[model samples]
Target: MFDLVYNTIFFASYSNFYGLGNITLGLFDVILAYIVTIIVSILVALVLKVPLLPSKPYRYSFDVSAIYPTPIIAIGILSIFLVLNYTFMYNGIVLAVVIGILSALFVKYLFDFVFPKPLDADEGEDM
Candidate 1:
């Protein structure tokens, strides 16, 4: 009974599984890619002089941080590439680094243009 269960679970083979052609990425590669993503993002953020944390105490702050959105954005982009079967031959690592740098640059330069601050309603009002 145990042998049957083992065979069914681990050894049973299908002709075509998910149409992905039995793509089983090594654990080491996946981990390396993630580490690369994190390291590159933090480095780029530091080079750009982005803060390590948000400036405002409130939620939805406009400030970019070395530890927050940069890594998140990097990982998100990496995930998309991984799902599309682009992670091969250490390509994932390279992609991660590129994404990290791009994200940091975007935060430094384009974030404000893309997400402008709200105008104050009481501005230029005379008391």
Candidate 2:
């Protein structure tokens, strides 16, 4: 469900002349988009709060699989746009911001999945 929303926003933004010809947008517009996406992702994480892994005392196991989805999705989508146009002429700042937001959201979801509360734990339990 979250993936759908995230991908939809990404596709919609890209469809709006994302990596086409030399189009220029204001800095503030780019910044606003980044901020909005980041905030939305954070809110989603807070609301879900699903721990993906168990917390341990000074012992750790990392789930690397959880770390790569969003960037892969973003890069794959951007690569398609760039390949289709044969140019990387989109707004750099905007792209960076978008990628950052996507990356953050992806990581948040990853952590939630990787560090989830124990099975015996009740809802609202803190780790």
Candidate 3:
């Protein structure tokens, strides 16, 4: 009984079975890609001097920073690539690093231009 349960659960957990061709990625590899992308993005953002956190009391602030958008951008882009089956290297470590670097740069330089903040005067009117 225990063996039956274990084998059933293991069926869908691997990229391929003993005699079948590989299709989906192993769970560990996809998770590793996400983790690496997030770490690299945060590190690059810190090195670039993007603020580590949002503005003070920023429950509603529009400010983009290292912790807020850097990882998010990196993970989001990585997801798109993964969905398209475009991991540039086996296990996707290289793709993760490249996405992380580009995301940090985009947040540091192009973010404000692409997503301009509203006028400060009325920013907190609702509060």
Candidate 4:
């Protein structure tokens, strides 16, 4: 979990360091980061059979179609960059890539605080 947070911070900072020569590219990177985070979070949720750390119920009602798109787009972009950079650095070990993916999941949970889809709309309304 710590590793995911650390790597996400590193990835964000690294992306920022590349300078803002291309607005399109910058947007792409942001979207990619978001997507990577979401996908990893979902996978972690399934694998762990629990919400990742820092879980908090969402404010809005559930909408499966609406839920997934943003993260997918974000991850797709960030992944392209991670692959380009990490491949050169680590020589493509599967373990390293898996770690990177896990790290992405960790960051998603850390920053976003996603909880399981609520069973009742009124479940946490008192809070």
Candidate 5:
């Protein structure tokens, strides 16, 4: 049941974009698409006014911000498509861009809700 729904969505998405699978695409192109997704996601996040880095004491901060989480999300999603052999139009260029944009927006708006900040910070509880 799970595989049926998974294949239906992933394969249907690729077929709609006329994806011919990785046969027509080289490893380099696939790699480039992942890189593009990362770059575009970061760029969009920056444009959305996300800080380039976390706040002071960055090492311990639990904050989720653009430069870090945005690209991470984009590449992760792109990897899913790659692993599923579901490259979309333009050798995944279009898919990468879409992923990048959506990831940035998600990080900017929805990440906090998904991963709420630690509320006991002032209590100095070791994490």
Candidate 6:
């Protein structure tokens, strides 16, 4: 029934990476890794005194905040590691946390140098 079809299609595709008897982490491990990433990101941002939200209006703000870039960057990096089959073992969780903290630091410090704002075209103009 459904198991037969699923095994045929899903395993066929998955076998390329996982192989016939490869050990893999469960869903809980994946979820826990993501949770670690998120929590570490926010905590690091708060410790560094990143604000709770963007300073300028949401539409035109590049500021990093406790609730914004921290979690987003953490999740993004975690997703990449997950796709590469890395999980929450052998200090993988610590690595994710470090990455999350580093990303927040980069956003706070080096982002402007890496992605500077464009000059205003109407500067020094009269109304």
lDDT score of residue 85 within candidate 5: 63
lDDT of 3 at 16: 43
Candidate 1 local lDDT, residue 53: 90
Q: What does candidate 5's lDDT look like per residue over 24-127, in tens digits?
A: 55555766787889889988998988888988799988776777888988877887776576766887899999999999999989999998888674689666
Whole-model alpha-carbon lDDT for candidate 6? 0.67
Model 6 error, position 113 (Å): 2.0
Candidate 6 collision pairs: none
RMSD values, in order shown: 8.4, 11.6, 7.4, 11.1, 6.9, 6.7
Off by over 4 Å in 1: 1-23, 58-60, 119-127
Task: Please provide, for model 1 over 18-113, each residue's C-alpha lDDT reduced to its tens digit, 9 standing for 90 to 100.
Answer: 574565455556667878988998999999999889987738565768887789888778766665556555646778788889988987888779
Segments of candidate 2 deviating more than 4 angstroms:
1-23, 51-127
lDDT (Cα, 0-100) at 7 in candidate 1: 31
Q: Candidate 2: minimum summed lDDT over ten consecutive residues — where?
A: 61-70
Tell me the tens digit of each residue's lDDT in model 2 across 1-127.
4353344345545555545333433445444444544444444434445233434432443332222333444444444433233222344335544554555566665545765635433455556
Cα-based lDDT at residue 110, candidate 1: 83
Best by lDDT: 3
Query: How much does candidate 3 score in TM-score?
Result: 0.76
Candidate 1 RMSD to the correct structure: 8.4
- What candidate 3 gets wrong by more than 4 Å, as runs, is 1-24, 122-127
Where does candidate 4 stray beyond 4 Å? 1-25, 51-127
Q: How accurate is candidate 1 locally (lDDT)?
A: 0.71
Please give each candidate's TM-score. Answer: 0.68, 0.31, 0.76, 0.27, 0.76, 0.68
How far does residue 119 in candidate 3 sit from its true spot (Å)?
1.9
Error of 5 at 8 (Å): 19
lDDT of 4: 0.43
Error of 5 at 62 (Å): 1.7
